[model samples]
Target: MRVKSPESLIAESGADLEGHGLKRTMGLFQLVCFGVGAIVGTGIFVGLSDTVAEAGPAVLVSFVLAGITCVFTAFSFAELGGAIPVSGSSYSFAYATLGERVAFLVGWCLLLEYGVSVSAVAVGWSQYLNELLDSLFGWQLPAALSAGPSDGGVVNLPAVVVLLMAATLLVRGVRESARATTAMAVLKIGILVAFCAIAFTAFQDHNLTPFLANGVGGVTSGASLAFFSYIGFDAITTAGEEVRDPRRNIPIAIMICIGVVTLLYCAVAVAAIGALGADAVGDKPAALSLVVDDVTHSTVGGGIIAFGAVVAIASVVLAVMYGQTRILMSMSRDGLIPRVFERVSPKTSTPVRGTWIVAVVFAVPAAFSSLDAVVNLTTIGTLAIMVAVNVSVVALRRSHPGLKRSFRVPLYPLSPVLGVAFCLYLIWGTGWTTWVQFAVFLAVGVLVYGVYGRKNSRLGATPRTGAAAEAARGA
Candidate 1:
């Protein structure tokens, strides 16, 4: 297997972006909005309940732990993204520093990360939509049509519908999608602020008395789950090809997105626990909406929170679906996947076919599968990807010492080392079942790479011997 050099990858990516008709219209603020939109969705609205169950009121500490780990990884991403602004995000960085084989595996893991995440978020949106409808109109979708088999329903029609809608928005254009995402992000943040205000009114000091009811181990476990909320900010890196002045914009946007979302997540966690208590929040599907109702003593408050959740999850589906298609497009261009996925529509300047393909694949599982299992799979895949990215930074620093990096990771190897260690620590907390599932997924990825990717890789077409070959081998 031939390794694609960093210089080669960057040149090819520039040509691919133009040849594939992807527009470079996203600015720093818009990119930051995309990250915020993706990062602050289902994780806060739905996953918080699961975190609360794991660590009780101490879920706040879980949020902090997850945020710190993500911050370290984010710095690595910013540095690499600035140096090699491409659509594949970590996959591209890995290709430049690791090898085609490693890059292919990274891309496969991302398929699981972004693809399944979109589906999971869509499912969460369906639940919140049902809550909103029932609150405002006094009627809900029939369970047979609204939920998956695991949730005692035949098909999650709402989930499928939301996925299709998000795909449609993406097929239109990135600018339009960014605008929509920004609007939704503002709306959701506003709702969260309102929720905090109301919840504080009902805050009971005793609710936080047994904050560490589940112990330090529980807080660590909760952080493992909370890590899911931090997953989507990296999706912004996937938009490297679409952003203007990517070198400067990518790093700035990543830091801003992480900082803003971490603050919001911590505040929301505190308010929710303070108002309704962790026990009440635990196991509830739409915990934010429940907290709103309990705090304000009105169905109207719940309805508002439910509506915010509907918009929040939609933004997540949009950003994640966009990231998935772009990653596939990058892979397809490198001949790792079928070329059909690389085709871009002249009219829309978007990969319409690949977008729909992802939509169908995402929608089906979401229509019939359970959320917890899929979420667990997504978190593990993401952790693996994060580890690869952090390592890529360390490797690139040594291999390409003179490369013009617009942003450098602070503290050099220390940042990336901590990033890897933190990611592995969270992975350990994910338990045996998640590890088994991740191993199975990677096994399938290896089979695919051996059977198809290695044979078809564009890089392997060129021969590199002597020092260049040695460099490729080192990479």
Candidate 2:
């Protein structure tokens, strides 16, 4: 029951990074690209249609609201990431300020968030890939193979394939993965900019006449959905140990990621609505492609947008899978999970085994399950994690006022307070079914901690025995 103190956690994280040989290859630009790569994915590509359905043309306001909420939490992430500069992101921050138990919970929630997120994004990728095939070749895979059970398909083979591809990339090494992600990010952003530019040409005032058709309630609901789009910004914080000059670069990268992605989301939302009206955008999975086709009156335009989506969702899978493996590595280093997860490959400097395991674990669901079922779960888990991180920042600041921080939240207690408040507000919008599911997930986490993690935790064991044993094995 011995709680690991902040100083001990910080020291241990440094030791883990050094002991495992994670390469510090990412500079500020790469880090920003990673953040952007993670943030600007399926949410805008596919979820935009859902947001419009909920909020009508007022989805533009929804994006702004969601972005503001994420901004508040991103500040908390930036401050803590700068101060801690560890790979676990919120999990490490919680262990420092809260305790081993709460840290385990945060790590568990992150597993749910990152894992489900990768799977959901993979499913989205499959949809766009199918669309691309149809548009470019006049053929698509049979529905039985291309869709999940909920969509009347036997399995989503494309989703599983994309997940495996991303897993292969991750095992190659962080530097290699970063390079690929950056290229994909640049390509996708370019396509999105092109989409907005062309879509605006067909913009009509009549399309926006009933902007508030769904009312304020719908806007709030849309914001909650849009919040998922912004979930990946904190994925950058998970790279703290691998980022050069983390204390400065982490915060800078987070802010830059948030700003760029938010603007892009708003612009896209406006362009889609202005071009085709709310009814056309709502409930359409390939709404962006539809807008492109309508604007240019050619299948080629839609095919191009679909191709961009394939690249965009693939990048999301890569970044999110990377985040999941790192979080598991951090947890395993603390003995909260199996030590296998912490094994960094000597040749690649990556968690090869863990990446494969994560890919398999999520791939099954992505193949047979529905996206809507899992996407909301990710949003709920992420919102909960954000609240915990905000609380952790407030506690750490009050307890350790003398700690050096390269980045500070702009408004002190107010910032974190609002961050938590906004998260709670969004949680309220997730509905009671999601709340029940979240409660069930937390209960399972508690059981696992009580059964295994609590007793085996490195922080609770004698240093000479626990960490020493692990180090001797070169884990």
Candidate 3:
């Protein structure tokens, strides 16, 4: 139950003089690209069809509301990330303000969010890979080789292949990873712009007649689903120790990433709807490609879109996998997990072993099992962690009134309170099955903490050492 002090956390973050810690090489541009790389992935690329079906042409409004919902929690993240600036992201933030047990549980939740997200993205990546390959080569991988067990296949080979490829890039070094990710981020953004330009060329005013097909209720529900599209932006905080001047850059990157993603999302929604009537876009997979195919009437335009999806999704896996390694590294440093997770390579200045370990752990599931159900855990876990972060802001404000926060959550209690409320509402929207699954996951986390984390926690060990030193002096 011991809470780490902010001073010690900050001290450890700066003691990175040599190869002992993550190298501080990323600036605001890299940070923003890192975030955009993670955020603009398969979700927006392929899942827009369902969202559009729910909200009609008004999916644009859904995207805006979803972005607004994320802003509430983003404010809290900006505040604490600026103040603490640790590699652990919210897990470290929770440790200093919420206590070790809470921190462990939060870390456990992050493991679900990042770990499962990678696998889920991999599964989706396989679909796009098949699309791009079929477009270019007139052939696709066999169903048995490309599908998971649930989908009636031996293993998802392409999924495993992509995950390993991402792992390979990550172990190289954060700078190398950053450059690759930044280039991909820019390329993907250009692709989206190209998509908008093409879709707009065929704009039909009559297709957008009933913008609000089902009124406010449909937009609300669509926003609930679209909210998940913005999940990867908070990943910016995971690079805290690795970012150059994090306090200034982290907040700026987050806000900028969110704004850019939101605008792109809205623009794409409008373009797709303007090109094809809302009814035509109803629940088709890869809706962007569908819009382009309808207008250009050729497999070539759709093929280009598929290629964009390929790069977009791959960038997501690379960036999000990076976040997962850093989160585990933070937990390992606190002695809440195995020390192997924290060991960074002196040569590369990255957690090579841990990065590969994470990739292997998630890659197996991506290959053998379908993530249709398990993926829901990520939504529940992400919401739960965001709730803790929102509450941590209030608790930290009260606990250490004088702490230096470069950016404070504006509107104080109301802002974070709304953040908590929105997150809990989304959690409930996931339904009882997900709640039960998350409950089971939490029980397992508690068992792990009791058996290992509590006994080995560095914070819990501190007082014992202090008391032993005092007793020796007395004797």
Best by TM-score: 1
Name the candidate, 1 or 3, with the larger lDDT value: 1
* TM-score per model over all chains: 0.98, 0.96, 0.94
Task: Tell me which residue pairs clash in candidate 3.
Answer: none
Candidate 3 Cα lDDT to native: 0.86
lDDT of 3 by residue, 1-475 (tens): 5777777787876654234777799999999999999999877886687678778888888898778768999999999999888888899889877878899999999987799888988887888888888878989999899988798888999999999999999999999999999999999999999999999999999888787997877786677667767878989999999999999899889889989999999998889889987777766767788788889998798899999999999999999999999899888888889989888888898888999999999998899876454556787888899999998999889877898888989999999999999888777666688789999999999999999999998766775457444432332
Clashes of 1: 0
Off by over 4 Å in 2: 1-3, 17-19, 463-475
lDDT value for candidate 2? 0.89
Clashing pairs in 1: none
Rank candidates, lDDT, best first.
Answer: 1, 2, 3
Judging by TM-score, tell me the better candidate of 1 and 3. 1
**Model 1, residue 31: displacement in angstroms?**
0.6
Model 1, span 316-396: residue lDDT tens: 999999999999998998999998888888888899999999999889999998788688889989999999999999988
Candidate 2: residue 49 lDDT (0-100): 87
Local lDDT at 179 for model 1: 95
Q: Using lDDT as the measure, which candidate wins?
A: 1
Residue 337 CA displacement from its true place in model 1, Å: 0.8
